[model samples]
Target: MKQPWIHNAKTDWWFILSPPFLVLLIIFVFQKQIQGLENHYSFYTWLFLIVFVDVAHVYSTLFKTYFVKAEVQRRKLLYLGMPVISWCLGIALFQFGALTFWSVLALIAVFHFIRQQYGFMRIYARFEPDNWSKKIDEVAIYTATVFPMLYWFKTPRAFTWFVNNEFDWLKNLPDYIGVITVLYILIVTVWIIKTIVEIIKTKTVNIPKTALITGTYLSWYFGIIYY
Candidate 1:
């Protein structure tokens, strides 16, 4: 017998995605107010971004590392040395210039975001028996996540990864954005249809993978459009 794609129940998967979704939703609802609140309610924004989303999630990796003795022992050098190396590299970059620091950091952050989405797709694909199905899952999630960043690149937006003027290098490239957005939508549509076909045949759906893709689409689209 084969295991289901989602390791947990549908409700559990939803629960996992809800907090970030709600945070994004709150940010979307308060997009305009956030700019004004920068002075008055700056701490709140800091708490939401730095505390809740950023630092909190970084520490969440402890579940895969510190909490797991075997993993910690296996990757001891990585667990121990990465922070020091990252700090030194950060200092070196900042010494170069603020632009260098932020530009590098922003690129790394975007790459991290893309890789994280891809990682989640892999997790959700653990039970997938077919190589083609796994590849489709990979492509769908990556397309959904990456194209929005490309939109941000070619088209200016109010929100940014770090600071203002950091990602303002590209201007008025609507044609590039138009093409990427269409390609993204077409890829997503085909993936959805394929998933539907699989569900109809197998009488089951991969709840976690679907939720991850859906949340990626919602968050990325709204994050770009709203902000």
Candidate 2:
């Protein structure tokens, strides 16, 4: 049977599962000190945040695919061809403009991040039967990740994806953020009601899934919208 925690309580809470929330917590507590990092500690910040976290995560994919002989042999053509194809496509994008290239990459990274979080939610909910609630869970997770991105597009802020001004072209739009905010509030309200009803009826809460969803909302909101 599928379990609530991914690995175990300590591992999940400290590392694999709750790291995003913890990172946000650190950001919150160190808000004043963390400011002006770009001016003062650009190299250190880039080394830790971008190289260690982001690039390391991307490179770790190789360990699962290319590093495994069976995985490589199972799909040799795919294993070999995809890297070349990606490189060529990346070159083609760069030929357009640096802004175009980086912007596309940044957006792709955003989508990848969203899907990974959604995957975690699904894994946590694996034991639950298929139902409308599952669909709502999917919607809530997507909205939690997506709304902040959309909000970022309309309103420029301090945070950046890959480089400075990567999102500049997307800023400014019709006054629909208010509408989106209302929809976001509506969705959160519905999710709250759904969770409360589930707890009342079943006398059990899907702890991991709830934590995943709630952490996603808070992290994205603070990382993108609030900051």
**For each candidate, what is the lDDT?**
0.78, 0.87
Candidate 2 per-residue lDDT over residues 1-227, each given as its tens digit: 34578889787877766777888989989888888776699889989988998789789998999999999999999999998999999999999999999999999998998999899999899889899999999999999999998888887576677888888877655667999999999998899899999989988888888888999999889888887
- Candidate 1 global CA lDDT score: 0.78
lDDT per residue (tens digit) for residues 1-227 in model 1: 24344445655456655655786878867867766887678778788968897789788988988899999899989988998899999999899889879978898989998998888777777767778877788888888788888877876565566887776655544468667868988998989898899899989877767777888888888777545
Query: What would the TM-scores of all predictions be?
Result: 0.77, 0.91
Least well predicted 10-residue stretch by lDDT in candidate 2: 167-176
Off by over 4 Å in 2: 36-39
Clashing pairs in 1: none
Most accurate candidate by lDDT: 2
